[model samples]
Target: MCVVPTVIGVMSGFFSLLPDLLPMILPSEVQITKASDLEAQRGGKDAPMIRQGAVIGKSDRMCATVLIAKPRCSSAVHHHGEQETIIYAASGKGMRHELSPGDFAFIPPWTEHQEINDTDENVVWILIRSGPEPVVVYLTGWGGDEAKADSID
Candidate 1:
């Protein structure tokens, strides 16, 4: 019998023993980034998907950014190593070809994906990753031959 699954299940459920403490935020520890102050961070040499407005970057286990996708734009193929991501469509019609505003999508670790906008309207998504910093590994193509470049720094 496989004991790995049993062990992992038990370990993952450890949080049930303790109460989730999100309501205990301290006033001094709260940090806010204004929309006008959002920084412009870049992606890979070939992948320019980042016209992003970074919000909660440098977190110990999460990074959040507002991504703006231009009309008729398709980003390079890439994957986040060991980091899962959750995307929330904040605005934009999303139309019939994309995620509508208020929609959400989750991407697992090491999953190869691309952000594509095939409509005439711009799309905006809030990207949140489970990592202190994003680990973008740009690829040549789907099921890429190998990594073209690794890590964003």
Candidate 2:
């Protein structure tokens, strides 16, 4: 028998508790990635305003990353094939109504959208996906590239 800690807030139901509690309840392994250990990566856009870092991935059924949207920048329109994405706004600007510290967005799989930061400050958010690997299918090409999303390998 094994015991696992419950995730107090944020998500709810079984899925919320599964990721962190899996190793405890089963014969699986758990891995933790410190904030200082993440490698900086582009936030799927050609602009410098958006940046991202992978928190946990590869060995798990899900992937988590932190996205930083700089002032006056907008990400190219894109979508993840069949992976649902949940975004938790940690800080910074909002698209419509004023978003507080803990506001979140549930993006359905294959939805096309873009993160626009019209404010003068950076907006930081946590992005959690439904799969271990990211499947980015850009609906609109970035940086004037003529390649279509469907043509990508």
In terms of lDDT, the best-performing candidate is 1
lDDT of 2 at 30: 56
Q: How many Å off is the CA of 146 in candidate 1?
A: 3.8
Over all chains combined, what TM-score does candidate 2 have?
0.64
At residue 117, give the lDDT of candidate 1. Answer: 78
Superposed by TM-score, candidate 1 places the C-alpha of residue 95 at a distance from the truth, in angstroms, of: 11
Alpha-carbon local distance difference test for all models: 0.71, 0.69
Which one wins on TM-score?
Answer: 1
User: Candidate 1 lDDT, tens digit per residue, 1-153?
Assistant: 999999988977865644444435423366777666654354432342445647456567898877777677776677888999998998764423368889998889999988887778667889899977767777888897555454221
Backbone clashes in each candidate structure, one number apiece?
A: 0, 0
What is the TM-score of each predicted model, taking all chains together? 0.67, 0.64
Cα misplacement distance, residue 78 of candidate 1 (Å):
1.0
